[model samples]
Target chain A: MSATRVTTPVQSVDAQAEWELAYRSSKLRDCEFTTLSGTPLKPLYGPDDAPIDPARDLGLPGAFPYTRGVHPTMYRGRLWTMRQFAGFGSAKQTNERFKFLLEHGQTGLSTAFDFPTLMGYDSDHEYARGEVGQVGVAISSLEDMQTLFDGIPLGEVSTSMTINGPAPILLAFYIACGERQGVSPKDLRGTVQNDILKEYQAQHAWLVPVEPALRMITDVMGHCAKHVPQWNTISISGYHIREAGSTAAQELAFTLANGMEYVRRGQAAGLDVDQFGPRLSFFFDSHLDFFEEVAKFRAARRIWARKMRDVFGAKDPRSWMLRFHTQTAGVSLTAQQPENNIVRTAFEALAAVLGGTQSLHTNSMDETLALPTEKAVKIALRTQQVIAEEIEVAHVADPLAGSYFVEAQTNRLEQEAETYFKEIEKRGGVVAATEAGWIQREIHRSAVQYQRALEQGTKRVVGVNCYQEDEGKGPQIEILRIDPNVEREQHARLTALKKRRDAAKAKKALDDVRDACSGKDNLLERFIAAAHADCTLGEIADVLRERFGKYKEPRIL
Target chain B: MNDQKIRVLVAKPGLDGHDRGAKTVASVLRDHGMEVIYTGLHQTPEMIAEAAQQEDVDVVGLSILSGAHMSLFPRVRDELVKRGLGDVLLIGGGIIPGDDVTKLESQGFAKLFGPGTNTEEIAKYVIAEMARRRAATGGRR
Candidate 1:
């Protein structure tokens, strides 16, 4: 194997002597200086590091195998959408926050749901007693969803909802809200994080079992293809995977593996490749590792484009694009010196832009302390603006494309991801691997290793491991406090809505949804009908839970 | 031999679903010679209290990030008290504000670990609390 490949010897004796002299004179920290994944880095990179045929490997942007970018002009034509993720308290409260963001020059709206809503429960559910309007906004019924986007024109604004377990019902609620606003389904454009495979692997917010979940996702794909043509039915996500502790290469490989699984399932469901493929999108995490994240994004686009065009035989060029939204790493934020997180988020957001993200969400500085206040959210939005208007990094497409270090890192990431794909294939695909606990174990191992490094002082997190600060001496920042009355108000509103809605019609619609779950009918239409009948989210989820059953995650540790 | 193990029930109360902190803490506790039982995500207060009783854990750690600590933590504490397991140490972590931490401690929580808390500090607190409880109970274990 070694004889078959070309080898380059280190022939720069003068450079080596210079490096040794500097190394001997300088006093360095007693820790390993490497990438986030422990990949050793050299002081300098040269042509030998990434020997590439530019014509073959480094193609132009918007061409086949789009390694540089998916668009011809990238950010020069139109800036990447400055979508700020905002939500908290009740629908009315979050609606105010949404309007505030839009007024402050936010280009798009990305919603964050409260815990009960994310877990597919109503505010009044016994299990959802204490957690109604915390973390994010609470949307239980069509009424809540309507109020959540009351004045915002659905046709004019693009919205992204980050909910997974009950994504279909939430999407239905959103469509119903749009229709009430006189916006046709075809005019509505947005994304729903309907990526359940990642839920089982990392995020743990899944509804039914694996087969039923995939079936429902395929149903959404087909349903949107015919009716909601502009809607992105699924945002296959790697954000949660990276936040859960996977490395850059693992995030790229596992996310693309999940994306391919969705593609295969769509094909198996008899949908044309181009019909549903164009609407497929992705979500990733921009962590503290700058070059590694940029490389991960570049490698993701190239691998996805090749697989879609060659392996899957996608004919449309739009089907080959791998557009993604990025949110700065929430796990990277610290509570000790909370203001330091502002600098961290700015760096991560800049890396996401340089890597050519279509949309971005910069996490608020106080997130590690609590949900972000309005003031903190505005600062976070300004971070993105400074990168776009002031920094001027988006003036060129793939600005670091030809750099020796970045190109080499991108190529190395691609090779590592390909190796992961082979390993996953040997374990019988992503779904099988997840079920067998292989994928979860891999993420767990990486997480443990990273945490161990942090504990052992190998990694330096400012204000955490190195910069010691007394508890009372740190800067005092105001934290957002969710009103305790929010839950009571939400419960009352849910009660009023339930009483006013025609019980027989809602019950019949829910029964229809349950019937569809048992048969081969697409569940999206039934779910929309149930949404029209004013069925609560928990009601819809409970109907399916009776037939398909909930998913019990396998123990990986 | 069974008494030598410091059994701990680690649970996520409510619907946060971000388990990096919980799992990492579980691993750290296990590494520190404690038997950790992780109950996974979206566990209600009732489920957590019941697990603490069934596992007979020396400590109950509730990891909440949804800012529902004021409501959820008290429920877990009251549930354990109702079950006559008030002697079991109750601890919490994850994104809780300083004011709420003071209130939670006042409500009988042994410790409220916030973000950036060192894992060694948590292990030390748990071990010391268990030893203190054993001494008070006449070393029943």
Candidate 2:
């Protein structure tokens, strides 16, 4: 409508006094001025509000304590990977989807397993009843893994698996699958959501107790650093934490603490920080809070760099860089008006790019009702493509770096995260604090508070709170339904595989897995053997569970 | 007429770990003066029925987000029938679609709320239903 209206820089004190005088007489809308988390906000932030010393705190891109960004050229050098999480039904179904995504210009692959597989149950297990390949693909053994990536060349593409409880088994399956395709372990590239502490803190998927789980993580990190050099052994994630309803600051604080705990554990297990550290990556959620989410990402990099350098004493610069993958907030999607979620995802993805993430996944609009249809997933992907091609935001690194609002929010988040760190330390460590339900209670408090605000009309969520939509009046979206036949087919396939595989080899492999759990041998090394011997995921996980024991979560309000 | 407090057991009856809605609903129901018992996570259908019988709960609310409702919800309702807790109202909420919600409602599920449902509405509905059921049944044992 109009060209930019430029303004001259004014003195901080004089401008504030003038603004304050006008604000007293001027009428304002009756609304809250705080952040989504209820953090108090200033009307207008100036240079004085941002007390950051750019030299020390905001170094140039690719420099020490990379608050600006991890790369010098940023997206100019390479655009952030557009990797969408995809899976459902059998491995055959998901494999077709994988090739479909790759053909459509998706840069990387992120796999989602079904609830039964995520919880380490086979299709035939009693606990797996009614849950085979409902949420994601069911990969019960090496045979399924091979079929899942049948035509795809592992040496060329990087895969990210969203598996935690049974991460080692899945990783071994991938390695064995790669070998079948003539890809060596050294040539393999990808990451696993191997951060187990968060399983207790938020995402409640785990096979063994905390102590044994932590041990398995250390074993994976140690083995991967030497063998699969390009593989990121762990993606310490805050995505599930935020999805579980933690505030932006809590998500940042808890995730960094988990990362530090891994470093501590790896060190204690006689592993070099520089060796495993460079491959350590992060995954975060890009929530609806625009400035808060951006600042959370910026502060995350700064806090992680400082922790890696000063606290852990890692000399390698790569080890200090906090590389992360982000996914848009799924909880923010309103099922009442499903189409509005596309706009929500677009804004959240922009925040991630501006905040400088290495990769991103935008949730489909129809995700809240069920797994997304093909059209929904495609639109979600195209949202990112348009942002990258249509918008000019990608040209600049840390584009919002100098804005007083962004810097202030970033500084405040860094300080808030530090306060949580001290509290977590006071309770021994991340494990002890999580075990005691302190972290969960904090998350619950935030979640309940948000709910209260939404109910009270203090927080306006378009379809839910403010703009009312009559029931059955809005357009209905077609949802993808999981075939009931998927379960029976999976069961038959598992039974047939069990019938054909050598019984002695499978049993011996499982016995070795059990021994590895009790003895000093690396568990992943034994897992690879089990994968070679055609051992099922449940077969190996069952042995590990028996040896390592099960974890019973402490109830939290 | 005797006054009987509304007792609701908010159970997570599947492998899904999404308890945010369940926990928030439990907290909200308690604020509205209802006795709320939450069966934390990863409870099977049989375990849910057993918990309801042990707690003698008036209502059982299951929250499942893993898309297993078609297979799981019926089994829970059946288990309740087997345990003689058939009078217990069964309701749920999750990522369930419209067709499935209609189908579930026909199968004895009192009402199933989906995402973006107001907790206040749930509380008010529970209270009203408890009153209507209590009046029709004469009195509780």
Per DockQ, the best of the predicted structures is 2
Encode model 2's per-residue lDDT on A1-557: one tens digit a residue.
23211223746888778889998899988788888888989888876677777767888899978999999999999999999999999999999999988888999999999999999999888988888889999999999999999999999999999999899999999999999899999999899999898989888988888989989999999999889999999999999898888889999999999999999999999999999999999999998889999999999999999999999999999999999999999999999888999999999999999999999999999999889898999999999999999998899999998888999899899999999999999999899999999999999989999998888898899988888778692338888988878889999999999999999999999999988887989999999999999999999999988887889989895
Q: Write the per-residue lDDT of candidate 2 for residues B31-70, one digit (tens) a residue.
A: 9998889999999999999999999999899999999998
Instruction: List runs of model 1 lying over 4 Å from the truth.
Output: A1-28, A473-475, B1-3
True contacts kept of each: 0.70, 0.74
TM-score of each: 0.96, 0.98
* Model 2: pairs clashing at backbone N, Cα or C within 3 Å: none
Tens digit per residue, CA lDDT, model 1, B65-124: 778888888998999999998878889898788888888888889889988888888999
TM-score of chain A of 1: 0.96
Q: What is the TM-score of chain B alone in each candidate?
A: 0.94, 0.97
Tens digits of per-residue lDDT for model 1, A1-557: 11111134555989878888998899987779799888999877866677665555657788867887988899889999999988889999999999999999999999989888887889888877777778789899999999999899999999999988899999999999899899999999999999999999998887889999999999999999999999999999999999999998999999999999999999999999999999999999999999999988988988899899999999999999899999999989988788899999999999999999999999998888778888999999999999999987988999888777888899899999999999999999999999987998898889989988888888889999989688772338987878888888988998999899999999999999989988989899999999999999999999888888988878866
